[model samples]
Target chain A: MNVLIVLAHPERKSFNGGLVDVAVKQLEDAGHQVEVGDLYAEQFDPVEHAEQYPHSAVASDYFYPLNEQRAHYQQDTLPQDVQRELARLEWADLVIFQFPLWWHAQPAILKGWFDRVLVYGGRYTSRMRYDHGYFRGKRAMLSVTAGSPGIAFQPFGRAGDMVAWLWPMHASLYYVGFDVLPPQVSYGVQGGGIEYQKEDALRIHLNACKECWATRLAHWEREKPIPFAGWEDWNSEGVLCETSPWRWRLG
Target chain B: MNVLIVLAHPERKSFNGGLVDVAVKQLEDAGHQVEVGDLYAEQFDPVEHAEQYPHSAVASDYFYPLNEQRAHYQQDTLPQDVQRELARLEWADLVIFQFPLWWHAQPAILKGWFDRVLVYGGRYTSRMRYDHGYFRGKRAMLSVTAGSPGIAFQPFGRAGDMVAWLWPMHASLYYVGFDVLPPQVSYGVQGGGIEYQKEDALRIHLNACKECWATRLAHWEREKPIPFAGWEDWNSEGVLCETSPWRWRLG
Candidate 1:
């Protein structure tokens, strides 16, 4: 198996980084080929703009990202960084997004990866999404860290539902035809406070979390993807069919 | 009312840009003081990193964004751009986020705005969030454009549920104590391609969408905020209390 771990943290020594290290070692030990897309280390530009396409623009006057994406991709002129990321995606059987949950979502850099790297016409088209998505057969999962503890992320928790925060990302992965696994959330990640860093208990807790991640990766292939309503579940109007069981849960 | 419209689209001539114009005109005509945070025009650096906090560092070795945010905020040494954004929020009674929904969420630039501008310790804290957030009195709403039609965003739709796509963002606003209104989603936004840009029907449709947005802004204050589970509805574990009415729907 081939694995791609995309890390989106600024500090290489952060807990998120630690988790990536653990996953790489664990997956490699399991006899898998692993590649790391260290976004911050590579200085991956998160913002998509006109500058990304100096040549091969379908319309030079107006800068529409989706159009530019489609045009550049068709012309085989996508930016080097985007092309590299795509190539990584093509090489991997499983993709893991490692990042801190900043502001109830993935960090801007990773969010931008979805924005820039996933070219509309080339990667997914109107008819080629959902169950029929481009990267079918691949598996993807999110390994997230949060400043808030586990108790605070339950349904109606002050930290808000972790499931709810992750839904968009999870759904996005599913949209592109990957079997999306449930997220591995490492809660109570102490950030920037000296006491938490110095405390032995916190250190022990973090180590345990790392071990949990390594253990999860060891059995990733056996995991079931999170269930989502696919094309067959919907009617012509694009709403859930009245007879669909998913309607009861998600309606 | 003081209104701040933060736009995240790259092109000022695009349909998203047209919506911003409509909003400014509508709000200003209603005798409201309006300010536009044109992120593209301003060239807002969406990526938050060590460079953003050169002067103020609680711990320089490992960069924890929230810690740096809180420390810089406390010391009154926040980056000038961030301070300016904060001031805008402080001054506004109503905030409108205008953008094209890229990757089933806000564009990375706007996502970064949420990541960087909303200071953790200063704008919100562990205790001072949800119903008791720092921006409790202010109302914030999203004005979004999508390439897919409205029907395509329904539950089980090919484009996925708009509600699910917007939930993370809506929850984030509610987390910060903003009275989040239902988003103004202008769907079927034709992008790039000379045909759609030149089509008379597309022009007519865009005008109608613009009018709809303007009309909504005219009665903005009269509109009720979308209901959310509040602190009172939750138990000690932060889960919705079993006895709470919200438990039936959201549990």
Candidate 2:
């Protein structure tokens, strides 16, 4: 299998960069061909532009019919680097995004990469049937480091459970047709004392990547439906159930 | 109150653009000052280079302090557009973002603005106490238009609910100390064949904005905690009873 690693942080010396390095090596060690998208080093523009749309071809199956709503595709121009990254995405079987959690999310460069490269007719939708859109059967995983303790991502905790924090990305990837995998998270990136205490965290994360690579086919075969809280059920059917942590029984 | 509208969509004729028009008129009618960021026109850069970090700040703040992470305070390399945005943020009383929902979230340009402009010292933690960080008490809202209907955002349904979809943005804003009003979402923007229906929907949204503006001061006076889902309760503790649609039971 061919893999793509999209690294977003600018500081090569940063732990996130190290994460990318290890993941790439591990993927190669597992005999998978790996491609690197070092977004910042490549100077990728996260900003979107109009020209990226492939309007000429109305190819029915693999493409989206977005000619009617092309106006929404317009955005400020993206730098050349982003276009290159998109080209890379077109050539991979698995996409691994490695970045530090900035403001509880991906860095601007990474976000921008998604913005610019995943155009209306590209990643989100295409001439294909709406239900069978872009990124179908493609795989994506987020490899990240956070300053807070991983425990904070749990229910009844301060921040949120890491899974819930990543729910949107998970759902979006699923919605857009990707066979999403569980995230590889390294918490306490900032002063967690883990950096000194566990010099092998990177190796561990890489091993996780190898496990992911080894089990890619089986993982897809046993794909788990993403979980949802009660609020989602209530909001949909207007069901007011008491004693549920997620939904409220308004008077 | 002076407000800034950072228009991110490229098309001046898109529905998102029209929403911006409505937002400006409403804010002005309420006697608040408004300015347009017009990001697409100005071409703001969301990526921050290492050179953009403030010169005099200690390395601890640059690398470790969560509050100081996003600010690009260095006078020399700081772009003029970013300076202008920071100035507007400093000058305005409210900030309203208008954009077409791209892949279930804001466009990359807008997200990038938050990434580049909302710095650690400026939007998160600053020289002031942790509680009094920059953007403390600043009010913000997201007015978005989606191609899908409101029904699609259901719990047991295929996609995420509209409110839950905005979780990351809301959490980021709240974590950085901004007060986020409930997002005003326009569902089924692409739903065909009824101009009058679209107008009616727009009217209701405009009214919501008007109400928000009228009660902006009062709304600020209270703390509105965002509600979460209760699946964890069933998973961890146990399923409770039912109440109203929005209300949930503990234990």
**Candidate closest to the true structure, highest DockQ:** 1
Q: How close is candidate 1 to the true structure, as a TM-score?
A: 0.95
lDDT of 2 at A37: 77
For model 1, the TM-score of its B chain against the native B chain is: 0.96
Q: Assess candidate 2 and give its lDDT.
A: 0.59
lDDT of 2 at B186: 66
lDDT of 2 at B127: 35
Q: In candidate 1, residue B127 scores what lDDT?
A: 84
Candidate number of the best TM-score: 1
- Docking quality of model 2: it rates as acceptable
On lDDT, the candidate that comes out on top is 1
User: What residue pairs are clashing in model 1?
Assistant: none
Residue A146, candidate 1: alpha-carbon lDDT: 89
Model 1 spans with C-alpha error above 4 angstroms: A192-196, B192-196
